[model samples]
Target: MKLINLITPSANLAELSSIASEHDLLLLRQDAVYLVHKAALPFPGKVLALESDVTWRNITLPASIRAISDAEWVTLSANASQNLLWS
Candidate 1:
């Protein structure tokens, strides 16, 4: 499965949604963690947010999005078939 990392709040949702599938994983980090506040996620896949980022921003994540640690982020990247970054 692909691991798609979003590092900015302005990352193109349309472009991301076009390439994402249910088997993929979408990781929200840095400013991208703000996406969890949106009404709905653009990706049709499992969504994970960096716990520290969310906490730093003082934003509470929705039930649909999981909050993961830095170690878990590394593990997810290591296990994925491909890693893609979207700024």
Candidate 2:
């Protein structure tokens, strides 16, 4: 299954990038204004959007960011973050 991670500003992007498996899709902001799918891990998994460049805002992230996430928005801790972003 594919997972879409709408990361919060407080979360760590670097860690997720390093270990994330090549099966997840990351959709985030790019111009620090809107969202973009930056990179991908591998086949069946892709990392989309530039995490560092994007601006982190609750409003912009949730609703206007990526067409409103239909899946459950899981609040992941630093540890669990890896699973959500990478796993």
Which candidate wins on TM-score? Answer: 1
1-87: candidate 1 lDDT, tens digit per residue: 999999998988989989989999999999999988899987899999999999999999899999999999999999999999999
lDDT per residue for candidate 2 within 1-87, as digits (tens), equals 244454453344566555545655555433322333323223334434443444343333333233322232243222243434332
Report the error of model 1 at residue 35, Å. Answer: 1.0
Query: Considering only N, C-alpha and C atoms within 3 Å, which residue pairs clash in candidate 1?
Result: none
- Candidate 2 Cα misplacement greater than 4 A, ranges: 1-4, 27-45, 48-87
Each model's TM-score, in the order given? 0.96, 0.32
Task: Please report the TM-score between candidate 2 and the true structure.
Answer: 0.32
